[model samples]
Target: MKNIPKVTALCLSIVFISLSSISNAQQRYTDYDPIADFYNRFWSVPLERLAIGKLEKIMLPNLKPKAEILDLMCGTGHIAATLHKKGFRMTGLDGSAKMLEFAKKKIPNMKTILADARYFTTSKKFDAVICMSDGLNHIMKEEGLTKAFTQVYKALKSGGQFVFDMNWEERYIKGWNLRGLRVEYDNSEGIISSSYNKNTRIGSIKFWLYYPIDKAKNTWKRKAWELTQYCYTPQQIKKALQTAGFQTIKAYEANQDLGDARNAGRAYYVCKK
Candidate 1:
């Protein structure tokens, strides 16, 4: 009876610690479905079109006509669509089913795979594999990024090309420190809040989306989700590519030839096996 208070306090402390662990885990994990479902509605507009168009023009000269291509992390199929129109056989792969649904609607008869880039595999190898638009930044772990690179290497045919782009650490440190960005479309709108942790080098963005109940009504539906991206330096990217068995690698800054200098947050990489 004399020791009852001490035992009770220890048990309470354990419970409190467990609860804190669970909360932290929840904060670290994010579900991508909401962002996927509303992806095109909010993103890949005129600017996205222009970027994809420019990228296609720059890469087209390097690829054989009608080459089989795999667009890894093929969000909303923007790049795949562009390449397909230019006569490349494209298969889009992404972890999000909802995003694939939108992509299918945009490009009918397109093949898509629902799998994480970290562990994705395919029996059908590709002539060229692309993971663009800073898709590698979403891995959140260096090991996971390496896994994705290795998987992509395995999925490419001999002497095949891998082209992708990544946002430099500079972008996260300076650009992603945003607060309450308001974005609007025809009948939908949203506010985006973003922050970057200097120590972790992880950038997080929270989206709050509003949809009109009716065109004339004041009522709206709301949805929210959080996304996180890890930052990598140019040297880190090159090392990953080399470790994944790429024979040669060339990285081009956005302003060099491919994209507009105004959008110089990212650099493009071309590697060959």
Candidate 2:
């Protein structure tokens, strides 16, 4: 073959390096999945305070939940605990053992099962299935999206609905160009933020952990942790749901009624099987 131009070769080399680093960055580590940490601290912590109100006003109000509610991808059982307190029968399902451990500690009375979101079952079916907080965007492939919807369809009662949301790529593109930010929860741990890489379309948040070497000493310590996930568009999500046997489909923007708005960047789907 002919020799490649230097400029073109350099660009190709940069892409290869980026891809290789992404692979190693996501490589699973010692009983610690970065996603689990994110679930445990970042979103879960805030949801613990906000999910109850959102569910009551946004999700559960429109319809009644006749039976139990399945919180698929329920990190730390944050929503489950609220439902449990409200006297609504609720159960949590998640694939991350690390997260489930923290969830158990938080909601000792609530029941939790370990299973992948794409294929999970329980002894009893649910009247409503809610997988919120951009859990829909985690389906890195078209097939995974269909499988998840199909499985949720089988698990829900005929009149029940599968509700979930995803952030738009526009949000990622608009946000990622900015440099990383720092938000320290304490000396030990804090959040460092960065928006999407336009070329790669990957957004990330790095968590830093600093420890005290000694109470009497002047110095402390530091550790680095990172989490990343792919982003998806509304069109891709809608097509996947339609193909997955959902008969009635409603898509909405963030903080809007569960009605169709294809152009909306942040999307929520209320799918009836």
lDDT of 1 by residue, 1-273 (tens): 111111111111111111001123223212445566556765656535655655565566778889999999887887688789889999998876777887898789888987778677799999999887777788766777787899999999998888888888666766787787777644667677888888987788787666665434445566666677878878788778778888689887776656466556677788888
CA shift of 182, model 1, Å? 1.9
- What C-alpha lDDT values do all the predictions have? 0.72, 0.62
lDDT of 2 by residue, 1-273 (tens): 222112211111111111112123333111233346555666676755544544665567766544578888776777777777676677887766787777788778778887776666666777788887666555556677777787788888877878776777865665444343444443343335555665665666455544445535434455565455467666677777777778788776653453324323556667776
Poorest 10 consecutive residues of model 2 by lDDT? 11-20
TM-score for candidate 1, please give it: 0.79
